[model samples]
Target: MILLLSLSFKNTPQKIREYFAFGDEEKKRLLLALCNEEPIDEAAILVTCNRTEIYISTHIENTNTLISLILKNCEDIIGMDIEHVRDYILCYTKRGAVSHLYKVSAGLDSMLIGEDQILGQVKDTIEFARECNTAHLYLNTLFRDAVTQAKKIKTETLISKSGVSTATLALRVAKDELSGFEGKKLLIIGASGKIGNIVLKNALSYDFSHIYVTKRSHNIDMSPNVRDRISIIEYNDRYQYIKDADVIISATSGPHFTLTKEHIKDNWDTESKKIFVDLAVPCDIDERIGSLDGASYYNMDDMKKYAVENNEKKKLSIEKANEMVKEGVEKFLKWELFQENWKVFSDATKSLEKEIARIGEKKTLEHLFYKIRDNGSLEALQSLIDTLSN
Candidate 1:
């Protein structure tokens, strides 16, 4: 039996979803924990900013025990009551589990649907599961096929043509708060990071007077002109420039807060208001700093409202993408049925071979595989199924 437990933006509020969010390290631990449990034969963990899903295969036909255990144990992980968790979490079993994963990989389940990031995130999730040694045959096949479908969706449809990604939404939220960027000094921590690079690219259109970047090392891929526009600040001295910055974007990898109230020299007496953007999972900006006199803080969850406001609907493209997803799902279903039939096929083929070998004929299992597959049709398959039944 396969089961999936999902806590996502669709059912849960952003504030609530944030509590369920896990870092890569946390996800690894969760996968390990699940696999260690009784009857949970194999497991995989998928965690992104918008969703957290645990896919598990178990020998237990009844999932009530598993569900109860998860709710009781993961309360600390998600910071919610069992009843409340049940309200937000969607549980899928068997085929439903397979369909849910396909949609997620295809970006149909994303907060910003048709966005490109989820596919890569799915790939990373699979790789992480493999690294944890928790990715068994079931998950490996599911993830691989899901990726195949996602790529096909990208290739066959125009859903990603008008891309309005999370990075764009983050900048959009920032733009809404501050009317103009002219003469504004912007400080970007973790300038070499993924969201930081997007912020840097998007900020080019804004008429900021200067852009201050704090990175552990220089971004070597930057063009000469863009490089000229940015002043590289030492990672440790980032606090020194806080007084001079009108806008500070922190997307650093640091687990601890990069911008605390201590970094604020004056008590909101600055000429212009300070805008702090925290895009890190654990959050690079201290929440207490939002209490300062004249500062506004916006995290990824905070920007989701703005993300929806600017979201555009690609109806035709989405329909086409969904059509492809249906085909993908059918493909997976057929493949799963074939895998389930293989055990019977293997046993019968071996029996037939032994009878032939007793009469002085020898052939490898590889030969038997080729012989069956080369002429394998629905009729032949049904015959094999009949033989197994007999």
Candidate 2:
């Protein structure tokens, strides 16, 4: 059985964050611990800002036991009762699991449909699993097929080209709100993540004069190409620049709010108009902060609404993507059936060959006697025997 277990922002995004807040080394340690406790064959974990999922390949027959094992592994990572999340968990087997993975890789399952970051995140997760020697043959083939299908869909369908993600849309909205970003000081919070990085890249593509990035760690160096246009700052000093900035974008993996009313109250006097785009799943900005004077906030759900509206124009492309998914599923099923049939045919052919050889040996001694008794007419006798065997 193949299982894809996900705990995301569905019921509570905080729970997902609490469970996966660890760094790469710690995550690897946790994975090893889980493997030790469970009957997992091949497993890969993908923990991101919005979701934490474990894709495992196993032969466990009891679904209840599998679910219990997963809960046990995650017991120490989350604050809530595992039973509370049990109802929301989704399970897939065989072809359904394959289809689900393909959809996820293609971003059809994303909150923001056609979001471009998921593909790379999926690739990274698969690569990490391979590096750790956790992925077996089944999962390796499954992930490789998913990645290939995703790329094909992206190139063949217009969904990715027609609809830009929330990050890029946020940049566009910022540009429009700030009037082409002329002489604007842009401040970006949580700059190391997928959405934050895309926002920074999109912002840089425009004419923004100055861009400042704030992250939890200050040890990492900024890219050389954008170092002139961007500056990195400590996470604690983020609010200081928020006050002076014309535009702000926040994409963090925190459980609670990163920007509160108290943080922005003091900054209201310095800026006439401030646009805050919160791309985080649970939202980094306090909802009430938008009520403050001279402040505007847009969260992920709002951006998703915009994306859905824009997707209407590209209905044909969506249809094409759906068709591609169907074709892929059909091809996989056909090949799988063919392999099963081929194995059956091979076994039957070997058995038939053994029976024919045994019969041939029995007839060899009889042939000489028949030839001697029938005045050396061995060719006619051989033909008769061959006909009877057939």
Candidate 3:
């Protein structure tokens, strides 16, 4: 059976969700361990700023053990009982699991509905699992089907017509606050992240006076088109450059705040206008910074309010997308049933081939045609011939 454990901004508070945020290395390690030590046959984990979903195929009858194993592993990150963890996560099995994945890939389950980034993220997670050899036929087929349907939904519906996300919204807000990007100095902390990179690339479209980016541990790889436009700054020196930036955005996976009130006090000019956007789960900017004069602060909660409004606007498209997801789920379930019976088909085909060899192909065909002619229609004979040829 296919199983899914979803912990997202929809159900989990930022305090609890932050503990489940796994870095790339952690994800790889967890994938390896799940396949190696647990009863899980296949595993793929999707980690984003808003959700951490674990998809797995397993034959374990009692799923509680597997669920407990996962929560136990996170004890070092956050000490929570199984009951407490259960309060935040939603688990799905079989058909429900398949449907959930379709909605997720189609971006219907996202905080920002119809955001384009999620489909790519879903694709990347399955690809990573394939690379680790943790995903086999079951998960590979399921994810591929989900991705295909997601692309179809995007093409057929007006779900993503607005093309809005926290990244785009942050840029829009920055542009509005600063009049325009033409003369503004932009500083992006945690530029290596998914949303942060989106913000960086989107900001590059406009003509900023100068753009600065900082990374904590991961390397920020800039493409040829953007290399000349951005200046790489050390993460520790972020506060030093605060005085020069008109817009500051931070999106990181870490639990700690990147911009604390104390850190900004020395560098912040009280009279200068500065816009701060925090796109992280646990939040990268200090809430106290909003109290500072001439500082505009926006966090995930602020982003969510905008997302709700965006979702409201796309209600019709969302309903259409949900119907598509339902159809995709039914199709996937049918395919899954076929896969379950595939070995039986293979064995039957092998047996027929052996029988045909024993009787000689010509003789077998003649006998089958004679029998069909006597008892069945010409169409039955033709069907038998086609089946044999196959």
Ranking by lDDT: 3, 1, 2
lDDT of each: 0.77, 0.73, 0.85
Q: What's the TM-score of every candidate structure?
A: 0.80, 0.76, 0.79
Candidate 3 total steric clashes: 0
lDDT of 2 by residue, 30-67 (tens): 56656665577778787666577778777676767777
Alpha carbon deviation, residue 281, candidate 2 (Å): 5.3
Output the better candidate (1/2) by TM-score.
1
For every model shown, the clashing-pair count is 0, 0, 0
How many clashes in candidate 1? 0
Off by over 4 Å in 2: 8-26, 173-183, 207-209, 215-236, 252-260, 281-288, 331-390
Pairs that collide in candidate 1 are none
Which of the two candidates, 1 or 3, achieves a greater lDDT against the reference? 3
Ranking by TM-score: 1, 3, 2
- Candidate 1 or 3, higher TM-score? 1
lDDT of 3 at 338: 86
